[model samples]
Target: MKFLFLITFIHILPQCSGNPLSRHHTTSEEIKREIARYSDIAKAIINLAVYGNAQNRSYERLARFVDTIGPRLSGSKNLEMAIKYIFNALQEDGLENVHLEPVKVPHWERGVESAMMLAPRSYNISILGLGSSVATPPEGITAEVLVVTSFDELHKRAQDAKGKIVVYNQPYISYEETVKYRLLGAVEAGKVGAVASLIRSVTSFSINSPHTGLQKYQFDVPKIPTACISVEDAEMMARVASRGTKIVVTLKMGAKTYPDATSFNTVAEIVGSKYPEQVVLVSGHLDSWDVGQGAMDDGGGAFISWEALSLIKELGLRPKRTLRLVLWTAEEQGGVGAQQYYQLHKVNISNYDIVMESDEGTFTPMGLAFTGSDKARAILKEIMQLLQPINVTNIYENGGGTDIDFWVRDGVPGASLYDDISKYFWFHHSQGDTMTVQDPSQMNLCAAVWTVISYVIADMEERLPR
Candidate 1:
């Protein structure tokens, strides 16, 4: 049946397009037949991935990486070691053209940090200093707390913000909506004459754990120390202030930034059997927050991308176009590694056929969110139909990853895996991001989908239209 399907697809190819170089050659029936052929191949790849070493190694290797190496913060020794490990692993896996590309990354260390409530009964508040935050004075600053739910409320009470520690208890509506507080909490509070700022973790659900991530300080505004507190603590303090209770807290952080550290973007490839110069890029960031093991955040992402290449190599399947796997570094620090990579390779951007990232947690497969021209989207939508057997057929437009944003902006076809990440933000940047949250079966399925999609794209008759 598979042979017959391929024969039919091949026979219809020239009749519709006359040449493989030109796209849009197939009639509706030919397109349907081609899609069916691709679907059958995709199922074969999926089966190979599911029963192959990726299912076990993707998770087990990540467990070892997290347990052995711990967090992979940019400019840290751990991240460098991670690059080395992955580079060596890829070479050992028989992936061709494996090497490390240098990137200078920021080094921010989270030293002794603490926050305490002195009023309304003493409580040791759980807090994680935001990455890159400046340390408070040696003695720490003790100030009255000003609680506000929104930036508008802060603007309204600007006068009261003077000499106070602004605490943003912004309720979590969605990650995209609520994350503004986390990113700009310090700048907004500094603008309002606040001594410091603390934002509730940007997650709809949280335990007593405090999540930490990168925060920005506008150069024109006063720099202030900032940290994230657990949702329970933020709400509790908000309640205290609502009852006219004086909320006073002491915050001390030892976070300090050091000189830029040298890092690398790990690269490996399966050279194309035909168009070796035309590249299909698949990637995930290697650097993660300092808090927990970066298992779910991106260990799954990086490894699954590697697994895609590994499965392809082990299966002796070579695409018509090169499949390049990039393990990006310093992504948590505003996509610094990917930025450098883009700068170094922008001249060849046109040769890039597609760039796919999996920074989002690799949960159950749910197709992809893509950003491309309408024609490209149509082709991808049809390709994704092959994945309906696993219920991952849904495809949406305007989807890409932070690392690949530059490529997408340059009009290169870009995509990222879409998964049911309902609990992703909850554990992101927190100690809860360890392997405890990862499911092996889910990781296997994610690897299967990634491998099939990237392989099919690389082996397609023509590159996706820009």
Candidate 2:
């Protein structure tokens, strides 16, 4: 870490006295002109990723990866294989400093699970046990159902919730808002004395598909069987309850949590030509829930990050600062791998010029969501102008990286790719997140956006103001 800062110092010393990157000495005009000078570099990156040999490369790579590795849940053998696969690919690609960082991650398995409606006419319900959920007894939990729309409503009728299975049929306002139920439904249900919880899938549109995600068990409350049911099943129970009909359901699950398993974050980089210690980071998570192929959730994001480095390497463009690609593990389990990486790397946080992530689906490219000082934003906006050929230059404020959030919160500039995610939640965390949902042309556009922005920033005259 000291070497990184020393390299930056040595590289900047000769030009430091009149350095154009000085926020205090340099005016906005200088920043704009300096950023404008990179237009040619950006255009080259865009052309190569979108129209040249690299076009559609990310899509093909992702398809092949997901088809082979399949779903890679945290602490699972599949995830380990996926990590080894990526490590080998990085080494084969001849990327610099390809290595792995070990971290302990939670290992939770979803064993055979089933739910059946026993009252108000027998019916079978499609269900997915939430991550880390406790299993129902061998005989299963059979009881009347208490349907509620929101936490407030559940609390209002807490007395009736006792000794029943609570079904949350909350409307899908948005993933950010609706996901709370999936994350906390079990705890709330347990608090109200419910034996089990059946949360409505956190999706806007579902065709009898149930989405599963990580949920927490509050040690203060008793652990109960928790799972997500299809939107159709949830609504049907609500309608039946509204009609004054009693609903009884039997829930059985064999889910279990074992001791933490060792996992690794796959890492590779393009070493800098000048300031090898200074770094610009790009990333995506490699692990996903054990559903579908996990392609849409993060396979698209991860491959595109790798593609960015590949594009720059093929173009013979060498940035002054190291451009590192980190394929995070256990991101689905609340960024466990990233948290550990942060702990190991934050000591040299000053050397991190910028951090970029692309966890959201790599659909059609829009622009970028940035988190940094106004001066940095101004520089980035001009830098983005180089992408006019592809028309993905807009910058929003709400988008940043989950894995890189720690660094951003600690005052480093951060970036996340902004794209069309109108239908992202529809397949998120569900069995529908397969490779079939990916489009080659769209992946090409997204890779273009990611490559241009990341390459330009790394090779810029000065790092963005922090």
Candidate 3:
């Protein structure tokens, strides 16, 4: 069945070679030989990283860094230290052009914040102020609660939300779908004159822990204090409100945003042996929320990206095109670092061969999500087959990371590591994102997958079609 699937896929998909005008060179025989050679090398790299001395060390290094640095919120000193740490580590590893590119990032500090259920049996609720949220009045606001699941419901019951605290008890269908509430809860609630808002944490399951994330308030709308509450608390409020019991809550917060501060996106590269100016880039965001150690959220992503280059350099392998590692800062505040990097490099965008990012947790390797033309996709399909030994053969289209969105829009092929995120959202922006959730074997496998794909793509005779 697998063989039949492969044969059918190949026949249906277009092929690409060194140049689009010279497609005749991408015949099956040549592709097969290329696949065989690269597959052997990739398998060897995977085995060396997973079963050899490199095993477990990647996770250990990441744990130590994250534990030592703690949370690396944008514009914080911790973030700068993390960048310096990676920059020095890359230099010590002998990678070339190890440097930091400047980017001014927003500085949001979460001061003392708390929420309490005042009626229907007093209960202290776990909460974390959403990023960029306004603080409640000095004494805080105590008001009856308005419970709604969806934005449509919020609109329908807009009249009832006036002078009340809107509590969004939305279900966690998926991160992409559920996060909409967290991102726009304040704007939606404020539009209806809500004094404050609390959103159900964006996670399938929670342990009475609230998750904090970035939320934006529309300029035209009134800005209101917003925070996330644990799933249990959200559901309990919803049940109480259903019974027509007035749910009163007191919300107090000291969240504040200051002037943008200077930060950096750390970059290091392994120069190519042949196409020196051409580049294959692998990246991950470095800045994270103030909560937790930021380990799984992005420390894992950034370190695994670093480990890819580290392993390649250690093994004494140089590809045809340069391999660049980018640890973007201020990503938690809406890709500020990445946007600046894109604007600065937009003129030379064509020089980028491919850009890959690993922002998801470094869980077991499930393959990659790709964004490119059909010809490029075909090449990727062939490349993914080499990862089959680790059960990472999946590759879908129209996928990449937030940091690479601008480049992908500019017609550059982009990719993001796909992993089993079944439990990622649970700890994602919460205090649960410590190093305890990481697995050493999975980290090594993630590094191996990233290394092989990047090396093979950089060494390929042609860049992926734009």
Candidate 4:
């Protein structure tokens, strides 16, 4: 069965001057009325997802996927298993044009690691080594610990940083502001010759949990072992330093980076009945951090994308444009898989109608955050009204996902799910990121949002302005 929008657009098509790809698609006034006509079709799609066969299905599938596959760290055998598992599952679902594209991803292992405070009332400090960080010497580095609040303070105390273990207790301002200390804390400390560095985890809310993520190393600077310490511990050590109490610590890590490993960008699609070459892409990274179940970070996002295809197929609703799902590999390693995908598919960029990603946790539904031209926003704005039944009719501008940032930056219409994120960072990148953080009803609403928006855009007779 065709998307109901095709029937609604039959009379509306007379108002458009040219083909979908032509510059003269629809006049502003004509588009306004034409989009309003889609309300019924939109309601049908939304109803089929929120109240029909797809209810809670995405959440159940996500739980099983993450439970069976655990954390899918890049280049691990576990991630390979996840790719194959989904490759088979997509075929089983009968999605058309299912395939995998090869890409080389970083292979790094976080071996046995720990930290101990030998002075100032001896105790153990929880630590999770940052990605791409080098290991300490076999005996580990034992040095006087230096606690500073920020990079400015470290530079002012450069003399004290030498031959010491620098600990950054920088206050959590925001993830964007605080995360710099995690991503480049070692490089900054190395300038002053610190033997090692420990950054307070970059999170606003924590129960003494340490979050691990990718860190950067400069080529010309000395590389030192770095890890994230619990917020509680970082504060305690800072108070000890304020009292002029001697703080000493020993750090040991067996972190190693092997040569790049071959991985894949898992792919599946529902081919268009009309213009198959024109595409509306939906995606989330299949790869995740090694610590948690990855259910919240992207397991939810990836499954919701699959659910988009699943729901559409279940309803027997085929769009006019192909809907493609690319489960990215090594996205945690700085969008490596997505960047490669962009390169391989950019020649067909002209055919890309829009791209969507849901890296943010699938929580309560709000609306989409779009990045595109004013005309595109107008089209999206009208389409968002269809979600009134679910109360997710808002549309934020200039927001897109990390994995799809490249496509948006190059002038393609891009969107990221914008929802309630109050507790999102609480579990991000920690062992706290598990299926418990997910709610089935919330995922159903999220899947409905992704499906409604993707399918409506794909089936619309007029193309969105780029």
Candidate 5:
């Protein structure tokens, strides 16, 4: 028995000795070679993106386009118009085979929304109904407000929440945690027979404009009216309630939901010369919330992607693999557009060389998160070394963005470019997200990063691992 065990251990040790993790590590020599190969191209793309005359022209055109179109909520007529505009713009940008794929999306109308305190220090407050929230009666629901910091606290005192407006005054910690209250606070409040629900805007900044996002209704509970008030208004309500005063809130919202409507995911491709079957995909969503002009939330991202491809073509660089640009719709409502695209093209997942998405607001580019095998990541690190001079240096392991989740799950490795998100969440889903809020210098920096990344992926010799 001892001899048999010794033999098995010896065999396993030799197998473990051949582990790739022990042998395959990023080396300075490899990085230096990659930098030498791509540095000139990276420098050229960066110059054009940040300081070139062409970039200025593109920026002005994009800013004007977003401003003119204004808000384009999912499945709305404005969104349809925006889709058409994007297709035309891509065609004009010299991209071939620009087309739209049909996708079904939910339609939620934000007709009118208002809320105010009726006791203590009476004040009108800015608010907006969360997408998919049920409308209050014609007269609106007036009830004493009950404030809680978390769902656990609400669960603890749920019995006392009857006939009151449950106000979730939870502070924003991170997008992962704060998003829970925005997505499901209504259902939690409704389970306890609350008349309505109001969540503090999911942002750290105390702007007076409310942030709006998608909300979900549980099947077992009645759907209650839900809205979000700005952090300032939420604090004021909390203060009034703390004084032991009967804080009555009058909320009037005409928000309602309609049947799913037809939307489209627009795609434009630059066919490759040698490896026509392999693809490098880049994109941003086209739909935005109804409050602002949708400039920073996604308009900037979409335009930068469009401009990057245009610049690549204008530079007369013909890639070896197909380069595709997608302007997805209904990303705000859900990832319906992305999911539909993935399903419609599931057979091509293996042929995708790399997918890159830029939905993290149009701030200065930092680096990129890679979600793939160590082999693919090692190759990506090589590419990243070329971008180091431009200050894009925060590559790490992470999943792809929401729209690319489908591809990533199906073993298609992808990346979501990182940007300086220090202030992005502040105005992310709020009316504060407008073209006026963007800094041209920072936007230019982002454009530079996008151009380099798109070009590298397009020209790569090997496809990323599946």
Candidate 6:
């Protein structure tokens, strides 16, 4: 099935005649003509970072910081440390007006958590409470387990759920679909008065560590203790319950919410020489889940954006329009940081030429996805041709990332660097998502592509007519 989809996509590639791969040689006069006519600043930025040694050093430095600092859960002390680390790094990069904009963020702490079966057979289970989950009572909630795979199923049999712990046994097929269960399962289960809810970890791969993410509570529903069990354990429980054997689960969690804390979004810019009033923004969320250092989830994205801007400055390349880098805060809990930024700076959005975000994990560059008018698309296509040498040739529509959607909705053109996502979902919210899991070489390639895109947009004579 995957092969068929690949073949179909390849066949349709010809419909987009501007694809750089359709042409043979990079040095060909025709290719050179395209490069010269279209500003290749973005591509140059990418090339210098990917192929040059300076960018490699930057990656090494940032990776070291991420590993040593560990997980950066939003509103946590580690997140505060990460913010300072990035702010200092940007200051040293010759960026102007490097500062943090204050943002109010929720503080949720994940303390000790454990779950086990005390039923037909005794066995301990691996689990982690989702962010923002209410703690189980001190004695813990021990009740017979009722498992259902979807909300519809739970709704149909909610009457049978009283005085029982509900286990959401759904399997996430993709990131987009799986995320729904991870984010909403608790609330759905809570609505029916389930003593507690255990959701199957939302990852394609099975491992001992349970995945964790944010969950929402309905206004009227009593908040219930919710946690995610490892996929392996979830399957084991499902098998035992299918045999008509009674299954009792004991869940203990120390999760709690404290008073809202103040955090900040770090911002830095390189003022444009000719069109300083016009702005081109590139960003990534600085905050991450309190697991595994968040290296692959977003540390790579934040570092890549910083490195891209630093490269342009080092090369003495001053863009035509101001280039801004935003290291956003509180992206994990909700898009609170991004929303606050838009509200605080809505006036600036009109001058914003384009916005790009790289929240996707660092992997080999595939191409770019954009959301803009036809004229803007045409302009980007012209610039994308220069990136063909680095195997980043694919370009598609729908270019917004989760954090950048605000800008796109406000009419600023948005783009997201595309990467091979075949393995992205496996470790997405799992504890396995550490810096060691990332490919340094591929991350460097991403940095190259992002630098090129930022440079092109910043150097364009106008706003690409979007």
What is the C-alpha RMSD, rounded to one decimal, of candidate 2?
5.4
User: Mind giving the per-residue lDDT tens digits that candidate 6 earns over 1-466?
Assistant: 0111111111111213432222332222333354465445655566677776565755586678787788888779998998888888788877988999999999999898888789877889888789899998888889999888888999898987877889888877776787788788878878887888888988878767788888888788888898888888888778887888889988899998998899999999999888787788888888888877788778888888887788888778888888999988998887788889988888866678888888887788887888876656655666676677786756687899878898898778898878887887677777788877787778788887788777877775445444
Candidate 5: tens digits of C-alpha lDDT, residues 1-466:
0111111101011112422223344444554465468888888777777767665655576688777788889979999988888888788877988989999999999788788888765788788899999998889888889988899999898987999999988978998889999999999999998999999999878658789999999999989999998888788777777788778888888987899999999999888887777788888899999978888878878877787787788777778788888989999978889989998888876678777888888877777777876656655666776777677755666738888988888777788767778888888888888888777877777777777777787775545544
How do all the candidates rank in terms of lDDT, highest first? Answer: 4, 2, 3, 1, 5, 6
In terms of TM-score, which candidate is stronger, 1 or 6? Answer: 1
Give the per-residue lDDT of model 4 (tens digit) for 1-466: 0111211221122223434555443566677676678677777767776787667888888888899999999999999999999999999999998999999999999899999999977799999999999999989999999999999999999999999999999999988889999999999999999999999999998899999999999999999999999999999999999999999999999999999999999999999989999899999999999999999989989999999999889878899999999999999999999999999999988788899999989999788888876667777877887889999988786557778998998888999888788899999999999999999889988998898899989988777776
| Candidate 6 structure lDDT | 0.79
lDDT of 2 by residue, 157-260 (tens): 99999999999999999888899999999999999899999999999999999999999988899999999999999999999999999999999999999999
Runs in model 6 deviating more than 4 A are: 1-47
Return the lDDT, model 4, position 414: 96
**TM-score, cand. 3 vs. native:** 0.95
Candidate 1, clashing residue pairs? 16-25
The residue ranges of model 2 lying beyond 4 angstroms of the native Cα positions read 1-24
For candidate 4, give the lDDT: 0.89
Residue 191 in model 6: shift from native, Å?
2.0
Q: Write the residue-wise lDDT of candidate 3 on 1-466 in tens digits.
A: 0111332224322333333333444564566567668877888788878998788777988888997889999988898898888878888879899999998999999899999888988899999999999998889999999999999999999999999999999988888878999999999999999999999999999999999999999999999999999999999999999999988899999988999999999999999988878889999988899989999989888988888888888788999899999999998899899999999998988789888989889998787788876667777778888888888887765567889999998889998888888889889999999999999999999999899999999987666666
In model 4, the runs with Cα more than 4 Å from the true position are 1-20, 23-25
lDDT of each: 0.86, 0.88, 0.87, 0.89, 0.80, 0.79
Model 1 segments more than 4 A misplaced: 1-20, 23-32
List TM-score per model, in order: 0.94, 0.95, 0.95, 0.95, 0.91, 0.91
Candidate 5 lDDT trough over 10 residues, lowest sum: 1-10
- List the pairs of residues colliding in candidate 3: none
Q: Which 10-residue window of candidate 3 scores lowest in summed lDDT?
A: 1-10
User: What does candidate 3 score in Cα RMSD to the true structure?
Assistant: 2.8
